[model samples]
Target: MYVRTVYATGDPAKIDESLDALRVEAPKLLADQPGYRGYSLFADREIGKIMMGSWWESEQAQRNSDDHLKERRAALLAPFAHTVTVDSWEAVVFTPSLQVQAGAGFRLSRFDVDPSDVDLLVQTFKNTVLPKVQAIAGFEGMALLIDPAKGRGSVGAFFTDRAALVASRGAQSAARGEATAKARVTMRSIEEFEVVLVERV
Candidate 1:
């Protein structure tokens, strides 16, 4: 599977309106597209930051989607978003045990890795980090997306509520350190966001 993430920021007051367009109308545009699997939206209301991720069956399908929705995509965000950035990656680990809801707690951790250790990083997550993370209280699910060529990856950790997410911060950091140490990767940033909307097709 593949994941394409779009990051955007603009007026904080326009956050709600931007989310509506991205979650409601954007899915309509993607629903019928080949290889489309799901869509998830995250937002940091304080900063007016939005992160949108869409799942596809393959890299080709993910890339081709840009050609199909280029103009429509731009127009959709024009009213509310001031700047946007996009990234593509392979879904190395995606297992959602719980269906996310509006306001669900989400934490995104990004890392920069040595391209040569990409495979090792994947293995370390599966063999070590996955089990440790699954044991965290209120952990609903987790997914690791990576771009081997760029040697960048991100982990999306989902929790049942804000309290659970807060309580697990220490554990999350420890696990992150362990994974990066073993994989020879460096942590970039880790931040929390609220899940605004989710759609599975």
Candidate 2:
């Protein structure tokens, strides 16, 4: 599947109202469009940020939806235009084999794997962590990717919220103590990042 993420920034105080509007109205407006799978809205009051993400079967589906809504949603969003910045993009590495719960949000976490432990790392993520995550309250989905050319790796995707991610992260770290220790001995480093823009799709 192709995924698109858009960030709309506005006054922190207004995030709740904006999110409420989208949660209640946007789906009703775009539900039947071709290739449109679904969407989720995220609100971060502390940072004055709001995110909108959607999944589509193909690039064409995204194009169609964007074009169909450009004129109409533009007017609906005008009042908040002054504080919003919109961005969209496609996914480079994605896996559809995983299952996630409903009503979840998204996140992008980056990890760098040590070459010697790569295989073990992959197995643990696919066989263990992934399952535990799927069972969480807003657990949505995730993608684990390796940047062979760059000699590094990363995971970017979604979660229901920061708390869900926190829980999963803790459980995974603890569950794989021995294996994780072995990997860490050969480890380079790891970092997590939030996806801010999805430009292509």
Predicted candidate 1 versus true structure: per-residue lDDT over 49-73, tens digit per residue? 8988999999899988977976887
- Clashes counted in candidate 2 amount to 7
Q: What is the TM-score of each candidate against the true structure?
A: 0.95, 0.56
Candidate 1 residue 58 C-alpha distance from true site, Å: 1.1
Error of 2 at 21 (Å): 1.8
lDDT of 2 by residue, 153-177 (tens): 5445566556666656664445335
Model 2 is weakest, by summed lDDT over 10 consecutive residues, at 192-201
Runs of candidate 1 with Cα error greater than 4 angstroms are 96-98
Clashes of 1: 0
lDDT (Cα, 0-100) at 12 in candidate 1: 89
Candidates' C-alpha lDDT: 0.87, 0.56
